[model samples]
Target: MTTNEETIVMTPLWLAIEENLLALEGQNITEENKEKTVQKLVGELDGKGYAVSKSGIKMMALRWALEDMLKVGRPMLKDLTKALSELTLEDLANPCHASYRVTDNLGKTWERVQKTDRRDALIQMFEEAKLDLLVQKAKGLDGDLGIRLLIEETVESPVILERMGIPQEKLDQVHADIAAEIAARNKVLSLLETVEGKPDHEKVKFLFSNDIPEDLIIEVAQIAQADIDKAKKAMEEELKEQQRLAEEAAAKKKAEAEGPALEDIPMDQMAEHIYAIREIQYFSDVEKEIRTMCEQSAIPKAIVDLSFSDPDKFDELEKQCEG
Candidate 1:
């Protein structure tokens, strides 16, 4: 064959030997054993119908190594070596070209070429490493709370959800469910704050006053109750001191102040004296005003009810109505 044809035919053999040499480096094969290893590799390549000589292999290895050392920086070489060190036999089975586009810290773009098999193996290893990191982060979280957080993160990022390979319909459902959960939790928290100093029965009544799901309300209430118990226990001594002062102040006021005999009045006539009754009256008046406004604006009662139940839904309905 001509010299040009000979060079073309010999290139692949040289590259194969170089790859094997790199693999040996990765394995940490001792220098004393490397010659035998390369000789054996030469035999295998020769058996495969390649024209390989020991001296030719040595020349190619030295040339390729020098070229790589000259072209690549230390950090990049270290990373490449580390990646090669972790390769498996299976990873080397399917050979293809894999192109990489990366940007360095100095904003310089670098295009690195890799074998497809190696790239796939690295991707798999990276995914597993990320999973391990996530598990470590989730170690102390309560059961499924960590998973819920992950789902939330996935739902928030459309790209992540798409990459997860979940069906579009399922993703939509998850998004809806997470949104409802967040809204319900926020509503529960708002109600809890509203009834912060109220009795448990009053708190339950106020929570039920909103159009929240019974199961969600119960769950949030239980969690809030636990937090309330912890806080109350911590403030127990302070509360006792405040109670004693309140009682002393009340006794002083009772001795010095005079008031009408409202206690002698009939229960029905004493409605204004009851705070619960006053609250009911106030809400009833507000409801009547809302109804009047709805009727005057020709708005449906359903829309008004939605406004009370879910302001978000009501706003959407209002926009549709306007449209």
Candidate 2:
């Protein structure tokens, strides 16, 4: 029922100093670095957005002032540090309240604990690094970028994980889970690369996982079939081009030849030259029709089939398919 104004209390400097002094009281300190440490603490607090009023600054500077204060200050702050240290499934259920109890670290509850561990460990890492910061980053990044950053950071960090206190078995599970995810991602990227244009949902899913909509599956299959058709047509056109070039080369050679004096020319040689010319002319005609068919569809199935069966008669086949 408390409003923000009613609930929010300016953290007193005496309280801040009391907490710091208690933590440092256990440490054996030399007097030479006391001022330097105090200055550093103030700077860190300021950087963290704690307002440094004159009273707050002076209270922080005075060690006796910190010592004289009742140690029964905010238990919430100590709880926050402990929460960060032994964060677990149980502790997560507690809202910020006086009666709420924190949980101890627990054991695994799943068969694929490795995958579960990686995500769980990453969550702990995110909590340590500051969930609020992650939320800010997620908000700043568009959906894809945010997801990418989250995955990359989770996969990379080691320090925050040391505090996670996950068992060896869970650690092993994390590694396996990360490897599986990396492999899946690579497969998705590979499939995306094969697509000439913007990738569709079906192709992405097919490449990455077995899950796909019936409509998307049908669409991808059609795309693959079309690609096959294009390849066939390209092959046919290339064959035709090769034939044309060969004929042209042969014609040039024949024109330049002395012809072995027409009377002396062998019958076989004459027949071979005639055959080369006819073949060249046939391919040239086929090449034109193939180009036309490519304009209609990258993988015109009927055209491709005809081109595969009788390349020399591709023009006639293409005309028949078009008709």
Candidate 3:
């Protein structure tokens, strides 16, 4: 073959490793034989095209090197290394903090290298070495290996849920609900702070109070009355119009069906009707609990005095008592 043709056909030492290994597999090779063979393979790959210096070979070797470091790394970092070794694509894309990202990437690269042939075998060499010693040495430098060890030692350890008495599903839902409620209430509470005074904070604290606050009756009434007045005004107008039409239609239908005019229909009393219905069923369990809590709790006698006599004076208290 011509020099150019020979050069093209000749596989580099790294490239020829597979062919050589396949040839060696048929022979009876022991531990000593395997070592000599690896040395020979390295020399041949180095001789042909100086494969060790090539980018592909260097990349492959670097990967193998990282894996070796992991297997022999210190005990403290062993868990971190194992965790890193198991990372998937989803793990890589997650928006983790920056330092964690670096450690994850190093683990991913090592895993990928371990899957390749020459690189895989090279890694085994290090895994068989004194891994704990290598890891100890690694912690001395701020390399990928060192960061991994540090992370392993410092990361918050996972608590076993079973031991903590938390069901996994319950824990997950609690996390999600807390996140959602916090987001939703943050803005409302912020506005309450700016527009209203710290009354909201006090109200929150007193919400479950056994003994209602001395001022609770007056405060609840003032707030509820304002809200009720606005709602009543709007709802009354709408309900009146609806009632007027219903009365006229009922009269017309009844007169036609009976062959005589129905007596003047009573004016719709929907607003009062709705208020009565609402007032009948208002007190919540929370309110009842608070009322019953009077034994050990200091309930403002003023609120208790007003609530028992005419709860309607405070709309929510009325609802809680009635509901």
lDDT of 1 by residue, 1-323 (tens): 25655643333543454455454444533457646665676676666556566466555644444344334433233454355445343333322211132112111311332434335544443444444444444444675455455564332445434434445676567568778888889889887898898766556555656765556656887646554455445457667999999999997765333223433434443332232323443656587775664454444344345457786864554444445
Off by over 4 Å in 2: 1-17, 20-60, 63-164, 198-323
Candidate 3 colliding pairs: 13-45, 72-131, 211-299, 282-319, 282-323, 283-319, 283-320, 283-323
Per-residue lDDT of candidate 2, residues 30-84 (tens digit): 4677556566656655654464434554644444433332233322234435455
TM-score, predicted candidate 2 vs. hidden true structure: 0.23
Backbone clash count for every predicted candidate, in the order shown: 0, 2, 8
Worst 10 residues of 1 by lDDT: 97-106
lDDT of each: 0.50, 0.45, 0.43
Q: Specify the poorest-scoring 10-residue window by lDDT in model 3.
A: 258-267
Model 3 local distance difference test score: 0.43
lDDT of 2: 0.45
The candidate scoring highest on TM-score is 1
How does model 1 fare in lDDT? 0.50
Q: At residue 311, what lDDT does model 1 achieve?
A: 67
